[model samples]
Target: MKWFFKILALSLILQSFQFSDTNESPDLITSAQLETKKLEIQNYINSFSCSESGGCNYIAFGSKPCGGPKTFLVFSNSVNLVHLQEMVKNYNEMDNLHNIQTNAISDCSVPLPPTEIKCVNGICTIIN
Candidate 1:
């Protein structure tokens, strides 16, 4: 029985890796695009839905806009799809790579995008 359990565990581990999928990488941000993305996020902060959580983890150029020495906003509301995409774009520019985990998010009714994304810890999952 012990040997059976060990083999089962080993197989499970191997199978986990076998089905793992990676997301698509976006075009690297240009100096112009980076500046523009920053304004987009800044303008987005005052908007509804996206700014409800105050601000999501986002980067501008190389600056850590959220979760930095100075946080941009408080966790207020659930950030929507558009905002999520923008956040991922900035993350890539700043090299803020996310370690993908299983899809356990309750509100993530939408299918996961084939792109890298960051999550809100135990809450919303980044499906970029």
Candidate 2:
């Protein structure tokens, strides 16, 4: 009958909509995942130890929307420098992608690099 055909057509249209492609991508990183990555990097950095001021160093971290790093993180030679740098590099890249995807805004103020890095009580600390 006409009514049965109309119902069938409506069901097919609804099924098509249910299976339609969306804007979301499987590879897209969510804000929560990004935050978790940041925290993991911070915790890794915090675990570093040093016995001498000479062993302390700093690296730029995070991407600002305008340009440059959002901040600098101080670490010590006691940690695996290459591994830490690689982790930070990956984090920076992820953050940059996140900023682009979110259309992030920023004040455009560049964070100043640390004047000095020193070992304080076995931890690397930024000195002004």
Candidate 3:
């Protein structure tokens, strides 16, 4: 009975060490959230620049989405096979990057507190 009590006490002590304080906060932000914020800021800056550059034509694809390579339509210049191949490769890369940026949120360590910081114009607003 005495030995059993000692074992139970030992287990409880180890368990206490394993658990962390509930009040403590995490220091990192999920990469997906960070990337999403970054993209938003980039889109905002690009729109400003586009406006300053005498405006540009913005196309809206209703039902269909913009595509590359295979379905590329040759307007005036005849599309080169090599160029098409390169476009396909670039499209794949962009797709992969999009997937990475869209993946489920996971914790990542950052230099500053994630909550207080916001990405503005591809830079952290808290620091600057």
Candidate 4:
């Protein structure tokens, strides 16, 4: 009984230690950061999807709906295979980053605080 109580108390102490009140909030991303994020999103779309045979056009941008790629990036007749491959890689990286970051920032931490914070232009406004 004594050992069990000691273990429970230690667990609670450890848990509370994990929660720290930050004196300063995390720096909100700047306008440049937002633009960069948008560009990354676009680049990710362009990269992940590629063209197929028979001059198939398969672009992976905005890939959520899984639309087919287009015939040509440039108006020229032939295609750029090397560029497509690089785009595919870039898309994969961006897709992964977006997913992870989005998941982390979605909703809020546990215990469900009654307040909410909305952010825009690197500023956060708390709302009831």
Q: RMSD per prediction, one decimal?
A: 17.6, 6.1, 17.9, 17.2
Per TM-score, the best of the predicted structures is 2
Ranking by lDDT: 2, 1, 4, 3
Q: Which residue pairs in model 2 clash with each other?
A: none
lDDT of each: 0.43, 0.85, 0.37, 0.41
Query: How well is each residue in 76-125 modelled by candidate 2, as lDDT tens digits?
Result: 77778898899999988888888888899999999999998778898888
Question: What is the TM-score ranking, best to worst?
Answer: 2, 4, 1, 3
What's the CA RMSD of model 3 in angstroms? 17.9
Q: How do the residues 5-105 of candidate 1 rate in per-residue lDDT, one tens digit apiece?
A: 99999999988875534675544444566456656665554353333244334332333323222122322255464665566465444433221221112
Summed backbone clashes in each candidate are: 5, 0, 0, 7
In angstroms, the error of model 1 at 103 is 36
How many steric overlaps does candidate 4 have? Answer: 7
**TM-score of structure candidate 1:** 0.28
The better candidate by lDDT, 3 or 4, is 4
TM-score to native of every candidate shown: 0.28, 0.76, 0.22, 0.28
Q: What does candidate 2 score on TM?
A: 0.76
Better of 3 and 4 by TM-score: 4
lDDT of 1 at 35: 54
- For candidate 2, the 10 contiguous residues with the lowest summed lDDT are 18-27
